[model samples]
Target: MIDSSAFQGKKAIYYTLGCKLNFSETSTFGKMLADMGVVTAEKGERADICLINTCSVTEVADHKCRQAIHKMAREHPGAFIIVTGCYAQLETEKVSKIAGVDLVLGSNEKADLIQYLNDAFIHRAEGTTLHAFHAVKTKDIKRFQPSCSKGNRTRYFLKVQDGCNYFCTYCTIPYARGLSRSPSIASLVAQAEEAAAEGGKEIVLTGVNIGDFGTTTHERFIDLVKALDGVEGIKRFRISSLEPDLIDDELIEYCAGSRAFMPHFHIPLQSGSDMVLKLMHRRYDSALFARKIALIKRLMPDAFIGVDVMVGSRGERPEFFEACYRFLDGLPVTQLHVFPYSERPGTSALTIPYVVDEKEKKLRSKRLLAMSEEKTHAFYEQYIGTERPVLFEKAHRGKAMHGFTDNYIRVELPPSLARDAYDNEIMSIRLGGFNHDGTALKAELT
Candidate 1:
């Protein structure tokens, strides 16, 4: 049992890096601690405990995690620091030697974090700062960790699935997260019910390679989507970052007809050249990605289709880059998420030949990013003078409040209004003009 003396009146703060899935899991941990009477530390208040949920998707992310840990160590010198997630799973030894980290939990161990922490606290010498690591490599995974993120976010994210089976040559997630696994349909529906009851307005389903949803029990993702639609009180639901090949006709059509599902799709198309696609071990080609975008536009003409593209993966010669550019330019996509490829340790990408120089990679990335800006401006122009329902967030940046529309447009509210009244409320706003170099929409209350 946990020593109530150690936790009863303690304050904890969490900082997360990486994807929405990480945020949801960290939030779940926060709720778990709160139930045990450990309150979150207030703003400008020093915390007794610090939790840093980490990511190691790229080399830069790993560097950022290390930098953040050292900064947290200095900022919260007396706090017991705990580290978890992908980076912890991969680099437990390095993290253990860090100045302030007292506990480290990996992917499998994190699923049982509460019990592990309790046991650790019981065995530890009183007032001693000792470091411990718990990282269990995933093997034949059968259970799904349930998670939800609220309060700090406008949309509640429900982690419907976890892990990845597709070992794309350039990707390290499959090894870090393990083979794909998902919670049963009934369990997720129940979570949706709880979220709806707790005043959650929008629920976005998130996962690592969510398209690879049911590897264990053979349940379909569509089944979960259909079940969630019937959940009462929630106004909207969104599927986050699905794979291009997995965006089937039935699934797209179901989302098109469903009232709750939003008209926005974020699909990963790492490369547009079929040659580079094969080299990267990606399952789908440029043509397949184009077809998926075409299908979404055919059904919902005003749909916002987001694409994720990698800039400088191995074997992306100048010709290949040109081909990729042409393919993306020809597509009816709205926005582009351009990532510069960084080599991860022990991946198939390391063995690939003809690595692009760092300077060349940056050049390619700049071009794609500039193209992204132009495309985004054109996308925003279409919505100008039109009206859309925007779901506003709780916090304000200085004098302005921010939010997003159903079609994934960023919106802002005037400083004159009562900010508290609009927080977490969806209001009809006329899209007026662009701000921040076409990155945000200026809105008028309707």
Candidate 2:
């Protein structure tokens, strides 16, 4: 329980990194602060507290977490700094040693922030002390932490599931997030209704592995989707990301004809080579991944598909790299999220042979990024001279406004449309020629 008067006039600012789940969790903390009468700090305003939600999936992400902590501390010298999320969960002692972090919470303890902060404030007023570090074992992160983003009304990331069961060799997510688990379907629906009430137009279902839903209960991911599609007020629900093996024809067919589900999918295909898949301990092979995309395209040709790829992991010789390149060259994917592999401490991938050098990793990353741009351009070219519903997210960004269609194409509107009336509102836009820089599609009001 919160005494609203405690925070009646204070302000808190938040900085988030990593996945949709992290953003959703941060929003939950923000909502708790709001209930306690703490408002989010306005632009260029000072805040009493600064919260940083972090990620440690890759070496780059870990570096970013550390940088953000130090940056926030330096920028707001007097603010009470709190750091939580994957990096904090994995490197609790390291984060606690950072110069201005007052408190560090593990993944499991993040949801208990309201209680922890309340105690800290009480001790502060009474001239007592509070612990700076509060972290539990990863195994204790068993329960689901329900979170929904309220900062953005166009699309609220609704975390229905948490943790991961598959401990892939090159991955630290399982160690950082704990085991796979989910809340009941009924519970998710209640949360979705609340988000809709908060002016959320779309709900992006996010998790460590959303397709692995219902492991605790008897329900399935399909069951959850069917229920959410029928919810009133929400314009659509988007599957943030999912595994290839978990996506079946049944789920694809349901989404194809659903009234609320969008036509977009982001499946991680780390390496196209089957040998690399085995080395990484991935569940499905390249053939199954291609088949899944084919099925989705057959059902909905206009569907946008994004794939995650790791450019340079262990056990990738020249031939294996060629196999991966060939596989991706043949696929009909719309976009690629290219990542260069970096070994994590205590992961099985460190023992794998043929470690790729950083130089080669950069080269491979550049190649894949070029491929991605070409694929994205081709995907957008098809929609030229077509009209689609564009949900304008930011109506004022320098000189132009930006929005996205149902299939996830970035549409840029002229300065004339840069009005508060179009912000967070869905409207029909006509796709015109490709921009001068070939970055985004030029769109006009239809």
Candidate 3:
């Protein structure tokens, strides 16, 4: 029903909120618009259409979404505003009432936004709302087809999986993203091969619950990695955030043996206390989480291990906090992503008793963050005076170039090294010493 002629050269701007998955989806949407002859422009610049991909993981995300819509409306009043993603899907009534939100599309209907816009402009209506709330049926949800070209990225995000099956007590992803689904092994391999052929040095396999991958397919996460290992041109592959319960010995061992996969694992621990884990409805206890970390250490001793922890959750006492600190202090983790607990609407944790005081939450967050710094510095110290493979990215912050070593240490190279290695090209570099901040390593081309 869309008359494509009306939008031939209209400029479009997109803003993304939330995780890597959201970014990947936004990039895919951008490519679609480009194919339709829509020019992509910088945010805050004049454009005919403004697309805001929103996140509703927390109340703060909701506030930011409203702020973005208002700001964009003020900058370009006549531009059509389209709101989509988890926040729009879950809080349709509230989002629709926002002053500048001209159209609201749910997750499934997001792909059809351009066509809807074309139709709306041709017909000249006040506005339109296409809220497709039906749970994305397995067939209705297209297997993540790579719509964009791969040569653009030194590292490409291949969405091998989608949706979450686990309904964590403090999470709403299950309701917002629907059930777990993944493409067939053949489809995933084809996509990875395309990225490899396009000169992508690393392919980060991302998803809502990547560990929950293969629930729909007979193939498991390890199986997918093994399949990708055979793909040529891709120097490395990385797994995004995964649940502690799914970090098995087999996957760790496979990563250890594989040349293509990087020696890094990002697992979310959420909480260290067994009581808190139970309250959060997490699948693994502290013991199991500890064992998983141990297995990764045993297989790949120098592997960069990242942990995700939430501070100030319901029923977390001082003893519980100390338990978390002690566990992390003794672990071989490279870094920690600490988050202060924030209430989200429709989540059970929001209504739970024993909420920590706001001041106490800030105190606990600071303590954990300090511990995280200590752990990160210790991890980076291990790679000093060693030669490791680094995938150099574009130069930034003056003449310095930055990249990540195989062990996931951030390395800074002088501008000279920047020319030989294109963005995402893997090369060997010898680490000189740690910077004063302890966050990165100073390195020279070997």
Measured by lDDT, the strongest candidate is 2
Cα displacement (Å) at residue 25, model 1 = 1.0
**RMSD over all Cα atoms, model 1:** 1.5
Work out how many backbone clashes candidate 1 has.
Answer: 0
Please report, in order, the local distance difference test score of every candidate based on alpha carbons: 0.86, 0.88, 0.79
Question: Whose lDDT is higher: candidate 2's or candidate 3's?
Answer: 2
Q: Which residues of candidate 1, in runs, are more than 4 Å off?
A: 124-129, 140-143
TM-score of each: 0.97, 0.97, 0.92
Better of 1 and 3 by lDDT: 1
The C-alpha RMSD of each candidate to the native structure, in angstroms, is 1.5, 1.5, 3.0
Candidate 2: clashing residue pairs, number: 0
Residue 125 in candidate 2, Cα distance off native in Å? 1.6
The alpha-carbon deviation from the true structure for residue 313 of candidate 2, after best TM-score superposition, in angstroms, is: 0.5
* Alpha-carbon shift of residue 39 in model 3 (angstroms): 1.6
Off by over 4 Å in 3: 42-44, 125-153, 396-398
Residue 396's lDDT within candidate 1 is 59
For model 3, residues 284-313, the per-residue Cα lDDT tens digits are: 899999898988889888889999999998
Write down the lDDT that model 1 would get.
0.86
